[model samples]
Target: MPSLEVIDEHIVLDILSSTVRLVGSLLPNNIEVVLHDLRNPECSVVEISSPSITGRKKGDSVISGARRDPAFANLMEFSSEPITYVLNYETQDNAGNPLRSSSAIYRNAQGMPFAALCINADYQQIDKAIALIQQLTASELNPTFKKEQQVIISEPTPDNIDALLQEIIDIAMEQNPGSNRPAIKKANLVAVQRMQERGIFIIKGGVEKAAKALGVSRYTVYNYLDELKAQNEGE
Candidate 1:
C-alpha cells in the first residue's frame, strides 16, 4: 500500500497542476505548488512547477537547497490558514536580481498544512498600462488593495479525546457553578453511576486506576462503590 503522505501529495499536486494550467492560460505567467510537511520536521513532499519558475522540478525538495528563504520558512510556520503576501523589495530573481512576486498558503483538514502557491506577476508592464489608461479617464485612480495575512494557532487540549469520561463532570460543574457544593463529590457520583451501568467496576484494578486517572481520591472511589451496592440492594 502507498503511504498516506504519498497519496495526499499526489492529490494536492494534481489539483495545483489543474489550477495552474487553467489560470496560466488566461494570464501571462504560470503558477506552482510547493509542498512541505510542517508536522514532520520540514520534509518536502512534492513540487509542481511552471515554465516561468526556473530550476525547480517535480519531486525535488526545494528546501534542501534554498533553506535560507524566509518565505519558505514562513509558509511552513503559517500553513494553518490561507496567507497571501507580496515578496519583499530585496527579494531576488532566478538571475539573482531583485524581482516582485506574490505567494499564498493552504492548509488541510487535520490542521496540518504544507502547500504554497506563488506567482510572479508582470508588474512593470501592468503598471505602465494602468497608468496610460488613467491618463485617458478623468476619474482618480485607486491604489491596489492587498489582503492582510492572518495566523491561526491551534493548541492540542485534553477535550480532543473522543471517549472523554471526565468531560461529563466538567460540563455538570459548568452548568451549576454557584451551587456551593463540592464538585469532586458530584464527579464521584457521576463516575459511580456510569460504572454501575457499564459494569466496569467489576473488573479488577479498574476502579482504582480510573479514580487515579480522573484525579479523584481512592476513598472517593470506594465510597462510590459502596453507594452503588446500597442502591442495588434497595432495588
Candidate 2:
C-alpha cells in the first residue's frame, strides 16, 4: 500500500502567510483579513491587515469574535472539516452596518485544524448604490400623475383682409347712415381710416375693393389714406 501525502506544519503556515499577503494586496481597502491561531483561543488574532476595517488589531481574541460574529462563529465545532468557506454571509459592525464575509479553516498534517482565515468585506456602499438605482427605476412618486395640465389656446392673429373689410363696411352702413352728406362723408372717411389700420389697404386689390364698397373712385380711397397718415404723423 502507498503512503498518503501529508501537509507539513512549516509549509502550511508559510502557505497561509503568502496567501494572506496576496489576498491583502488584491482586495480593496474596505476589506479586512484576519489570521487566527486556534491554538490560542484567548488571543486568537495572530495577525490582521486593514485593522481600520474590522476595528481589531493583533492579539484580539477569536473567542470574542466567534461569540458575536454570525459568519465566523462556531469555529470550535469545525475542527474536522477539511476546508470550509461561506459566501454572502451577513455580518454587522458595532454600529450595526452590514457586511459580506467569507471564512475558512485549514488543518495541519495531524488532521487537526489549528488556524482560521476570515475576510470581511463592507458592502454598505454597494447597498446604497443599489438603493439609489431602485429609486431611479421603481419609484412611486410621480409629479405627472396627480397634477392637471391646462393649455390656454389663444385666438389667431392676422385676419383675412378682404373678409374683414366687408364686415367693417357692413357695420358702418348699419350704424345709421344719418341725414346729411357731411355726416355720410364723415362716416365713409372714418370707415376708410379703420380699414387702413386693419391692414386692408396694403393688400392687392384692397383700394379697388374699398372704392366699390364706398361707391367712390380709387382716388378718393388714396386721399382718405393720405389724410389718416398725416393725422398719425402729427400725433
Candidate 3:
C-alpha cells in the first residue's frame, strides 16, 4: 500500500462524509455515517440524524447502542467489498415498528476499504413516491442496473494497451447490446480518440493516472491504441 499523507486522508474523509449528508438530507429518512479503520477493523466511528423527527440532533451518535448488535456485526463483514446491502425489513426502531436499511462501502487509494455509509430511508414514503412518479409519468418504473467492471492497470507492460482497449470495447458492447457493429466500432473509436485527446499515452505519465482519465485500465488504453494502429493499417 502506498503511504497516504494526512491531508489526503482528511480530504477523502471529508468528501465521503459530505456526500452521505447531502444524500441523506434529500431523502425522507435518517442517515448514518460510519467510518472504520481498515487498518484496525474493530474501531468504528458513527454519526446519525433526522431533522423531521430528531431536530437539531443530526450529528449525534445513536450507533453506540447498536454497535454490538448482530446487524452491525454483519455490517462489518459486508464492508469487505464495494457493495450495497439491504440488511433486513424486520429491523425495528425505538417505537417497535419495522425498518429497512441500506449500506454502501468505500475504499481508499491503497485499495483498503475503511468506511460505510448506511441510510435508513422511509420505505413506506419512498415506495409511495416511486409509485406517484410512475403514475405521473404514465410509465412503468423499471430501473436498469449496471455491473461495475474491475480493470487492473499496472505500470505499462508490453501487453497493457491491447488488454485495456479490448476491455473498453467489451464494456461498450455490453452497455448497448442491441447496437449495430458500426455503432460499436464508432463508440470504440470515440473512446480511443478521447484518450488521445487527453494525452494519456504520453511517455512519462503514470499508468494509474492514464487509466483513470480513460475510465479504463492502463492496459486497456495500450490495447486500444494498438488495435487502432492495426485497424488504420488494414484500411
Candidate 1 vs candidate 2: the TM-score winner is 2
Clashes of each: 0, 0, 9
Model 2, residue 121: distance off in Å is 0.8
What would the TM-scores of all predictions be? Answer: 0.35, 0.46, 0.34
What digit string (tens of lDDT, one per residue) describes model 1 on residues 1-235? 2223334644765687577667766665423333433333223334444434334444433322221245543554433344434363223333433335555555554434545566543344456568666654533443453334445332112221123345444654565454454755665576556443333343234466557656777787787778877877999
Stretches of candidate 2 exceeding 4 Å from the true structure: 1-5, 64-67, 109-111, 125-235
Off by over 4 Å in 1: 1-12, 29-52, 64-68, 78-90, 121-235
Clash pairs detected, candidate 2: none
Off by over 4 Å in 3: 1-8, 29-59, 62-71, 78-90, 107-113, 124-235
Predictions ranked by lDDT, top down? 2, 1, 3
Q: What pairs collide in candidate 3? A: 160-219, 161-222, 161-223, 162-222, 162-223, 164-219, 164-220, 165-220, 165-224
Query: What TM-score does candidate 1 reach?
Result: 0.35
For candidate 3, the clash count comes to 9
lDDT of 2 by residue, 1-235 (tens): 1111365555665677677778888777778888877665545677677666656666765532311354454443434456656665777553445666778866554445577888878776567678766665554565343323434342222124445556667667667487588777777878886665443443346688889878899998899878877987999
Q: Give the TM-score of candidate 2.
A: 0.46
Ranking by TM-score: 2, 1, 3
